[model samples]
Each structure stands twice: as structure tokens, then as C-alpha cells.
Target: MKTVLFPVLISSALVLTACGGDDSPSKAPAPEVISQPTVAVKVAAAEPVSALERGEQIYKRCKACHTVNEGGRNRVGPNLWDIVGRDAAAVEDFAYSQAMEESGVVWTEENLSTYLLKPSAFVPGGRMAFAGLRDEYDRDAVIAYLKAQSPAAQ
Candidate 1:
């Protein structure tokens, strides 16, 4: 019994010696980082459309219903001579749908592109009887052509 007690005490002592103390130093509190408020930025306006080199090709579809030459008579729809920047449904000597007249929208590049893509969607109940141009590039080209024909743009 004495021999067994001696060995148990030695083992316990060896285990206590093997257990290490904490060696790391105390750390300072970290500073808090405050985030700044986000601001909305304004971008510069887009550049104006240049000459209609590709527009002639795109205008093939539009030519069925619109004429670009000044003094050209209205076809199924009003003549689109100098259409850009013109008041909506303001073609003289031609009857216009109430939907188009009431839209009160001016024909800008953005507006014209949207209108050309889906005329019925742009001006609900308007009477531009043809299906819309689906391609964005083609719409851009058509807008360029209309801009070229505008009196102010000239």
C-alpha cells in the first residue's frame, strides 16, 4: 500500500509539472471604424448621334409607313420628315389617333427608340398600324436617321 501511494503521488506531481502557465501578454482594446454615408453620383450626358450611314439600311422597314423627305405626303401613318423633337401626333394635314395626340410626349432619341421598339406599348391605342422594330441597333439607326432629318439637328 505504501509503495502504490508513492508511485501515484509521483505521477500526479509529474502531470502538474507538465501543465504550462499562460504566456501571452494582455492586449489593448481595438479602435472602432466608422463608415461614411454613401452619396449618389451624377454622370455626364451621352454624346449625340452622328450621320446615318447605317440608318438607310434600318429605315427600310420604316419606309413602308413613313417618308423622311420634306413635303412628302403621309402614307398609312403621318410622314416622319424631321420627326425627332417634333410634338407627338402633330403632323399637319393628317388625321392622328386620340391616343397619340393625348400622349403629350416629344420625340427625342430615347423616346423614339422606345417607341420604335414597341409603338403600342409606348402610346397605348395610338394608330401607327405597323409592328415595331425589335432590334436595339436598328432602332438606334432609325433614330439617327430621324435626327438627321430634324430641322434643329440640321
Candidate 2:
């Protein structure tokens, strides 16, 4: 019995030592962090289309209702030959909404961007049925296209 007890105590002592029996609050070892590789991944930046080109794509949507030629006639909407600096509802012989006529908005690039984003919001009760161009880039492209074709541009 004594011999058996001696071996058991030795076994327990060895296990306790092996398993870190020290009750004194010992700080854990700090973890090692590996540094990243020096080589960086490269990406090809997309070539952006000229504003006129991009706006042409956007204007396709407007062409059904408006024309951009210098002496074009009005369709469902007014001809937009010199629309850039024109006052709202200023197109002669074209009917404009009361809200638009009274809104007093000049078609500056900034104003056009805002109006094209959401026309009804810009001019409530206006007759432009197209919901709006939601993309800022698209609005900018469209405005650029209009600028390129304005009477000044001609």
C-alpha cells in the first residue's frame, strides 16, 4: 500500500508540474505577428468615355421626347438645342407646367444635375414624365452633352 501511494503521488506531482500548476498570476507570452509581403497587386483603371459619348447613351432615353438639333421642332417635349442656360419653361410654343414656369430655375449644369436626378422633386407638378436619372455620372454626362450642343457651343 505504501509503495503504491508513493508512485501515485509522484505521478500526480509530475502531471501538476507538466500542466503549469503555478498559481502566481504569470503574464502570458505575447503573440508573434507576421508582416505582409512587399509586392502589391495592381489593377488597370477603366478608361472613362468622353462626356459627350456617355451623354449620347443617356440622351437616347431623352431623344424620344426631345430633340437636340439647332432648328429641331418640339416633340412630346421641347427641342433642347440651347437648353443649358435657358430658363425653365422658356421654350416658345411649347406648353410647360405651371409649377415649372413658376419655379424660376435656370438650366445651369448644377441645376440640370439636380433636376435630372429627380425632376418632379426639383419642380413638383412639372410635366416631364421620365422619373429621373439617378446616377450623378449620368446626369453629369447628359449635362456635358447639352453644354456641348448649346447655342454657345454651336
Candidate 3:
């Protein structure tokens, strides 16, 4: 009985030793690699037109109050013929406000745009009844036209 019991115990101990213990380390799977599609992009360029061309289109609204040719007479407002470099309120026959005469503002592109945008804002006491052009593109075109009308640009 002891001989049989000893052999059975030895076999069980050998089987347990062959099986690895829980202390052994485990391994993880390798990471996967993915690829993305490439895209192409393009940009457009900006093209600016001459001031006269823009101004001519803008002056359609101004035709009711002003004229821009030789022998052109004053209508509701004084004739704007060759008025780019001219002094403000300098028209001889037409009456001008004292504020306009005293304002001492030069009719440059900057000044014209500001005055055309808002006359009362530019000169609080100004008599020009027409509200200014709200669109910036229209303003630029009108200024370009006025600049073109000037002898200097030609």
C-alpha cells in the first residue's frame, strides 16, 4: 500500500511542475499601419481695374447733381468737371456754405471716399443733400473715374 501511494504522489508532483505558474509574463499584439489620401489646392489672383472705369459706372448716380465736361454748368450741385485737384467751394457762380469754405479739405481719394460715404459726417455743416455711396467697390470706381478725369492721370 505505501509503495503504490508514493508512486501516485510523485506522478502528481511531476505533472504540477510541468505546468507553468501564474507568475509568467504575457505578450501583446503588434500595432497596425494605415494610409490617407493626398489632395491638391489652387488659389486665384486679384485683378484691379483703373479708377476711371470704376468712376464712370459710379458717376451714373451723380449725373443728377453734377456735370463733368467743358462748358458744363452747375445743376443741383456745382459742376464737378476737373474738380479733383480744385479747392473745395471754389466754384464762382454757385453759392457754397461757409463751412465748406472753412473746412479746408483737399479732394484726394481718401477725402472723396469719406465725403461720398457720408457728406454730413465728413462736414457737419455741408449742404450736399445726397447721401454717400454705401458700396466700397462703387466708391473706388467713382474715385478712379475722378482720378482719370484729372489731367495728371491722363
lDDT top scorer: 2
The Cα RMSD in angstroms, rounded to one decimal, for candidate 1 relative to the true structure is 12.1
Per-residue CA lDDT of model 2 for 50-75, tens digit only, reads 98899989999999999999889999
| Candidate 1 deviant stretches above 4 angstroms | 1-51, 152-154
- What is the lDDT, from 0 to 100, of the residue 7 in candidate 1? 95
Off by over 4 Å in 3: 1-51
Better of 1 and 2 by TM-score: 2
Model 2's lDDT to the true fold?
A: 0.89
TM-score attained by model 3: 0.63
Model 2 residue 141 CA deviation (Å) reads 0.3
For model 3, where is the 10-residue window of minimal lDDT? Answer: 20-29
Cα misplacement distance, residue 84 of candidate 3 (Å): 1.7
- Give candidates' CA RMSD values in order: 12.1, 6.0, 13.2
TM-score for predicted model 1 compared with the true structure: 0.63
lDDT leaderboard ranking: 2, 1, 3
> Ten consecutive residues with minimal summed lDDT in candidate 1?
19-28
Q: After superposition, how far is residue 35 of candidate 1 from its true place, in Å?
A: 57
Candidate 2 to truth, TM: 0.69
Superposed Cα RMSD, model 3: 13.2
